[model samples]
Structures are given as structure tokens and as C-alpha cells.
Target: WNYQFLTQLGYPSNYYAAGEMTVSQHLEVSGQPDPYNPGWVGLDYIFGSGMRGGSSGGPHIANLGEIVDSATDPGQFPDRNTIFAVTSWGYGLGNSSGTEIKIQGASPLSGVANANNFVDLFNAACRRSRAHFGTWTCDLLVP
Candidate 1:
């Protein structure tokens, strides 16, 4: 994460850590309507890490950084946008919301494609700015 974005999220800067996902989950849309992939669909990848707190609708960035900027609304810094996945459920619910954040199942390709569409629209709407944010209204961004 960039120090500018970090600070904007109300966190102290100077922190840089990376994690490698060690798991992959496959699923079926038997009882559901699959958008990304029709029947017998498979998800990209699912991961688990130790995150205490973060915004629910924030973006999930890849190590490469700035895959697609999605936060383009007011109060959101388009220049600091770098999203690969839409932040989904987490592990601090009953006790906070949940910390087991995972990338949207549509990410890898389908999800990213959908997000790209939004990004494009966002850029057009925000004068060539990202449409999503890693921490738009986040309360905290610390380890």
C-alpha cells in the first residue's frame, strides 16, 4: 500500500508486507444463477489472512498494484486507486465484522472484467479517475 493511501485511510505509514495465497476454492452454481461462469463454474482463488479491520466495500489489491482503479466517487482519491478485487465478506462480524476477507469470485478474469467496466465508467465520470477505492471510508488500515 502507498503511504499516501495508507494515511488517507487513517493509518500510520511505513508498512509494507506481502502475502501469498496458499489456497484455491472451487464451487458449483447448481442452486444458483452463475454470472461469471455458467453451470458447473469454478472460482478463481480464495484466500485467508489476518486482518483486524477494513472497509467492507473496499478494493482488494494485487501485489503488482493498481490493476484497476474503481473508486471514483467524491472523497475517493482516484490516483490512489489500485484494485484487483472487490472486498467481500470478512472475519469480524459478530465481534467486529470478520477478518477473513476474500476477493470477489468474479475477480481473476470475470470479476476483474466487470470491475473494469465500472472503472471505465468511473473514469469517464470522474475525469479519468479510478472508480473504486482500497479504503474509501475505512476507519483503520493497520496490521
Candidate 2:
């Protein structure tokens, strides 16, 4: 959605603000990253936007590029790339340039099946929430 803005010089077309996708990679975290997981949790990392406070659930999307990046509807969900993760937290504030986003898959459950199981835990949480209304369920606590 590019639009021409009126300028002081009356040119009205000097600047353009087109939105595009950025690239990043996934890596393992070492330090005491998340407070919820005080122990070793095998958390992963990736360079992200300068996301500040109250931006926890934003998606970290990667455009697959060209052939796979074509947008059928120009702008829509699942258009050109996949969301590998979401904005978790900023690593203790300084400059946001070195900030790395933590993916949601890694956990301290310590098992082959525990990794990349947010969907399961989330679904379980939902089910637990539903069942709790009827006194037949428990909390799905993800570790």
C-alpha cells in the first residue's frame, strides 16, 4: 500500500515506504535467558526487530522469496512465507540492534518429544481451561 505524500517542496514523490521481509537464523541460547525457566532450557535465538514493551506475541515471519513469495492476494495470511516464531522478549535492554528473538519451541522438559511442542501444550491448556469449567481438568503447565 504505497501512497504519495505531499511535500514541502511540492514534489510529493520523493520518499517511498514499501514493506518487505527481513532474513534471520535460529541458534541456541546459553545464558539464563527466560526467568520462567531458571534452569537449562535449550532455548533458541534469532536477530529480530526493535520490538519494545507490550510486543510479546508478534510473529517473526520469513519470506521464502520469489517463486514461493508471490502474494495471491497481495497482502494476506500465509501469503509468501512461514512464521517460524513470535516476539518473546528483549535480552535485558541496551541497544536493540543486538537483540535476538527466542522461539517458542525450546523448553526444559528435557526430552526428544518436548522440543517444538507448543501446539500440544497450548491445546492442552485450552482443553484444561475448558475442563476446569466443569471440574474435570487440570492446568497444562509448559516447562
Candidate 3:
């Protein structure tokens, strides 16, 4: 999911938009240094999207669809509709004709460098939420 504003729309309009994108690829991008800041390491998934701005930091959900029963389709993990990433950035070309083709990216929730750290952070957030809301239901499914 993303909230993007078409650059052509110009400012003053204050017309921001929201939309969803299909995961064209679940990339395992690791060990890459940030081009802008060499000291930082990068890990993310790159996918296709339209040419609009302000989509960064949106949640990228996984298993986002109707659930099938285990009896009908066994060997399925219990986690469904889980957000596994957030929109990081997008890059591509655009023309004056307003036909823009761009690709976006996000850092995956797991299976990369510092994955354990990510898990810890998630669990910490869950714990904080549980405490703040006075509910014991906030928990992370850490495999």
C-alpha cells in the first residue's frame, strides 16, 4: 500500500493518493552499501509501481488475500495478512506525456542481514503495545 502524489498535479492542489502494488519480486537484496551513505548497509525488495511521489514508508503486506482452510490446502503457515515490509524508495523514468514506469523497494521483515535484530525490534514493539493498551494479545509469532 502507498500514498503517492502525482508530480504533475503540482503543489497547492494538496491531492495525495493511496494505492496498492503487487509484489513483482521478493528480492533478497543484502550486503549492498547505501549509494548515498556508504556507511549504511541496505537490504530490500524491489518491485514495480507507477510514477508518483510520497509513497515511501508505506506498509507492504504479505499473504494479503482470502484465506484457504488447512483442510482444503494443508502445509500452510498460520500467518496471514501480515505486513512484512515498508515502502522504501522508487526509481525510474518519466516523460512529459505523464506515462511513467517506475520500480519501488522495501526492506523485508525477515531473512536478511540483521534479521534477528528486526525480530527483536518487532517483539519490543509488541511488548510496548501490550503494556500501553493493557492487553496481553499483542505478541509476535517468532519461529
User: What lDDT does model 2 reach?
Assistant: 0.39
> All candidates' TM-scores?
0.30, 0.31, 0.54
Residue 37 lDDT (model 3): 80
The most accurate candidate by TM-score is 3
Tens-place lDDT per residue, model 3, 11-104, is: 1111234333323323324345655687876566555555246556556655556775657554444455566666666666678686866666
Better of 2 and 3 by lDDT: 3
RMSD of 1: 15.1
For model 2, residues 67-108, the per-residue Cα lDDT tens digits are 644545654334344434454545443456855453332122
Lowest summed-lDDT stretch of 10 residues in model 3?
Answer: 5-14
Residue 99 local lDDT, model 2: 58
lDDT scores of the candidates, listed in order? 0.33, 0.39, 0.54
Q: How would you order the candidates by lDDT, starting with the best?
A: 3, 2, 1
lDDT against true structure, model 3: 0.54
Predicted structure with the largest lDDT when compared to the true one: 3
Q: How high is the lDDT of residue 83 in model 2?
A: 39
Model 1: worst 10 consecutive residues (lDDT sum)? 3-12
